[model samples]
Target: MNKLLVLICSGALLSACAGTNIVSLESSVKQLKDLRDHDRDGVIEAREKCDNTVLGASIDNYGCGTRKTLIEPLKVDVKFAHNSYEIPSSAYSQIQRLADFLNKNAELQVLIEGHTSKVGSVELNQRLSKNRAKAVENVLVENFNIATERVSSVGYGFERLADPADTEVAHSTNRRIMAELSHTVSVDDMIWTIYTVDQTQ
Candidate 1:
């Protein structure tokens, strides 16, 4: 009889322990679920220092939006000789400055605009302008290691002249290559915006 009584008490203790363990396990699971990312900002609730972040905003590891400055309007003017598309060695420094700027801002892209004087035929000027733009683009891509996809070239020909006067100085000024850089940057406490303008225009 005593043996049977002891066995009944042991069984009860085992059942009670099992019930306690099940409840504890459920509580632990609930706590884990609660610790999951509630805001869905790629950060978990346990480690997230910032809460309620704006959707699609660029963020750091701490779940905080990163600060960024708008890139200023950049214009690089590279002069070309009359009826020539060759980039002069003197222009290398000017082109290098543009390349340095691009290397610093990896997200920015540049547009090379080529222009010509009215001294040549319309078709020839157009082709010459295109070649001039391409020449600058090649130096940026090949010599400076800038990505080709980030640089683009376009020819304006004599359609867009810096000086309309029919003088030697005006013609020299008109025959030029212009580089325009632009990109949108993410700023903290504000929406992503693009603030760069074509200063050459």
Candidate 2:
């Protein structure tokens, strides 16, 4: 009887040890999985604060994207001849600079404002101002390869003058083209290669 009781107790101990081993194995597997980087974002799952990050995007130590909000401003100075809507060759350099800025910020839009002096009749000045604005817009679209939808032009005929005085300097200053490009955008803090999957095939 004593031998029989001892054999039963030993069997029970063996079953208990098997259960412990199974639990231990499961725990080890869980730990290894937590240490893996499923997203391949340089951070392990155990330490990752963000999940499913975009492939090849710049990320912090916690696997979160590092993006910055920036406000960029651009100014263009173009002078137009009296009673003329032609864009001067001298202003090409200024327009090129504006073009470069727009190309850098592909999502940005520009507003071109054309102004005229009060020497001509209001009707003539209005038409001339509008034509001058359109001239600049055309140069930007045709010569600089800027998108038509990204640029807009408006003419203010002697209404919003830089100098209200009826002097030669004031008139010259008033007859000009003004452009401003400003926008807020989120940009990656660091350069990274973008990965894309082609499905067209």
Question: Can you write out model 2's per-residue Cα lDDT over 1-201, one digit (the tens) per residue?
Answer: 112212223254455433232221222222355788999888999889999877667888899978889987778878887788888899999999999999998988888888999888898888878888888999999999999999999988888888999998888888888998776878765543332334223
lDDT of each: 0.82, 0.81
lDDT of 1 by residue, 107-138 (tens): 88888999999997999999999999999999
Q: Each model's TM-score?
A: 0.57, 0.59
| Candidate 1 all-Cα RMSD | 11.9
Query: After superposing candidate 1, which stretches have Cα over 4 Å from the reference?
Result: 1-71, 182-201
Q: Evaluate model 1: give its lDDT.
A: 0.82
Range of the 10 consecutive residues with the lowest summed lDDT in candidate 1 = 21-30
User: In model 2, where do residues sit more than 4 Å from their true spots?
Assistant: 1-68, 187-201
